[model samples]
Target: MKTMPVLNTIKKRLSAFALGVVDLVVRFKRTTEKMFLPWDKWVKPEGSIAREKLFSRFPRYLKEPAGSVRCGEGWYPLVWDLCTAIEAMEHLGMPRIGHFKAEERLGGLFVRVESGSFIVKELARDAEHRAAAICEECGEPGSLQLGHGFAKTLCQLHAAQRKPHKVKTVPIPENLATQRPKLLFLDTEFTDFDYPQLISIALVAESGESYYAELENGWSREGCSAFVVEKVLPQLTGGEFFQESGYAARRLREWLAGFGVPIRVVTDAPGYDWVLMLDLLHHELPPNLYPTPLNFYSESLPELRPLLKQAHDDACRDLSPHHALQDAEALREAWEVMKEHLHPAILRQYLKL
Candidate 1:
C-alpha cells in the first residue's frame, strides 16, 4: 500500500508537468506566428492587432481576403468570441454559414449572416446590444452619441476627438449675382424650437445695409435649449444693440422704412425665422417689406440647393455661426450665389417684380 501511494504521487507530478509544457507550447506557437507575420499585419497604429487571425481562423465566414476591418478594434474580441460560438454550433448539425458581414451602422454593431438558424440571429443581436456599451475605438465603456447629422459609439476619451462633419465649400459662379428686387436675408436666434422666444434678430439686405438687435428682456434662460445655450448665447455681445422688445421693434421698423424700395424677406426656416420677425414687429410690418416672406429652401429650387449650402458654409468659415447677424450674412451669401439660377417665373411669383 505504501508503494502504491508513492507511485500515485509521482504520476500526479508527471501529469502537472505535461500540462505546463502544453501551455508553454501553445503560447510559443502564437508568439512565433506574430513574429513571422508582416509588420503591418501584426499590429495597427491604434495598438490593436490586425484582423488577419480572424480571417484565417474563419475563412468560410469572411469572404474578403484582404481589407481593413469593417468595425472598430474595441469590438474585435467580441467579434472573435461570437465567431467561435457560431463555429461551435457545427457540432449540433447547424447549417453552415453561407455569407457573413459585419459593420458599424448608426453608432451600433450590425451583423448580417446568410443561412443561419434563429439562434444565430439572436447571437448577432446580443452582440450588437453589448457593443452599444463598448467603445468602438478602444473597447472601453461607451455610449452612442448623436450630433452634426451623424451618430457614433465612443468612450468619453475617444468622443472628445470626434469632429463635426464639415460642409464643402461651393464656389460662386462668376456672373451669378442678382441686381433686381431688394432681398433681405433674415435669421434669428431663439430660446427653443418648441416655444421659441427671440433672443436676437438680424437682417442683411442685398445692398449691404443690415440691422441687428438683441432682446434685453422677455426671454428666460431657463427656456433655452442646450444648443441655444451653448452655441447661440455665447456669441451675444450685449451693448448698444441690446434693447427692450418694444424699442427693438421700433428700431427694426425704422430700418425697414429706410429701404424705400419694395423688399422681400428671404429665410431658410420660414416657420421659425419669419414667425419670430412678425412677432417682434407686433404684426404691423413696414409698408416697404413684403407681407409674405420668401421661402428659401431646397424644395424651392432643387438645382441651386447645393450651391446655396456651399455658399453658406463658406460664409460660416469667415464668421462664427449661431450669432444672428453672422447667420443672416451667411443666408445672404447663399441667396446671392443661388438667385442667378432661379427661373424668372419663380422669381416673379416670390418677388412679384
Candidate 2:
C-alpha cells in the first residue's frame, strides 16, 4: 500500500511536467508569429480593429484564438499587429517584418512593418528612390518636406526660394551699369553608340533666338576628328557673326565668344557635351561656368544612391520622348528638385553632401 502511494505521486508530477513543456512550446510559436507576420492584417482597411478580433494578455505571450499571437515592447506589438492585419487583407502576402533600423525611405523614423504588397511596396520604393532628389540629400520622416515646382518634386529646403524662371522675351534688369551678353543654350544630338560624329545641333539664344545645324550626311570619324580642317576646307570660312558658310562650325565659335566673363553654361550632360566642345572648337571653356555636379557616380557621395530610383523616374516622366534639349531640361529640373531638400549653402561644405 505504501508502494502504491509513491507510484501515484510520481505519475502526478510527470503529468505536470509534460503540461509545462507543451505550454512553453506554444508560447514560443506565438512569439515567433508575432515577430514575423504583417501586423496590419489583423485590422480593417481604415486601421480600426475589427469586431471579430479579440486579444488576451498573459505573462509571456498574447493569445489569439484565430491563428496568431502578438508581443513586443513599445508600439512594436501594435505595429506588428497592424502589419499582420494588412497582409491578411492582401491575400496573406506578409511584409518583411522587423523593428525599424536605418532607412532612407521614412527619413529613418521607426515605421511599423505593414504590408509589403504592390501598393505599400511602391510607396516604400518611392521614399528611397531619388538619391540626389534632395539638395542636402536627406529622406524619410522629419526630414525636408517634398514639394512640387515646375512639375518637379522639391524638398522643403529648395522649394519656393528661387526667382521665377524668366521667359525668352524678358529683358535684362534695368539697373545694370554694364551690358550682360546673352547666353545661348546649346545641345547636340547623337545616337547612343555613335563614337565620333556630328548628327544635329540645336542652338537657342537668350533672346529666344534659335537655329539647327544639320550636316549634309553627318560627320565621319576622320571628319569629326579634324572637323575644322577636312569639313572647313570644303566650305567658306570667317566674318563677324556669319563666319564660315558651314553654319554649324561658325555658329558654335560665335556662341563660345559670349563667355568673355563668368557665366553659367547650362547643359544636361556637362561631362559629355563640354568635352565635345573642347575637342571640336579647340577652346577651353571657363571653369566657373561649369560647376562640379553631385552625381551618383561619385564614390564620395553615398546619400545620392538612395534617391536614384526616384530621380530616374522623375527624369523619365519629364523626358518621355527623349531629345537633346528635353534631356537637358529634365536634368536642370532634377537639380531644382534636389535643391529643395538639400540647401546648397550647407551641402557645399561637406564631401558626402
Best by TM-score: 1
Candidate 1 residue 113 C-alpha distance from true site, Å: 70
Query: Compared with the true structure, what per-residue lDDT tens digits does model 1 show for residues 282-319?
Result: 77877666666766763645766677788778877888
For all predicted structures, in order, the TM-scores are 0.47, 0.32
The list of candidate 1 runs beyond 4 A from truth reads 1-180, 340-353
RMSD of each: 20.6, 25.3
Q: Give me the candidate number with maximum lDDT.
A: 1
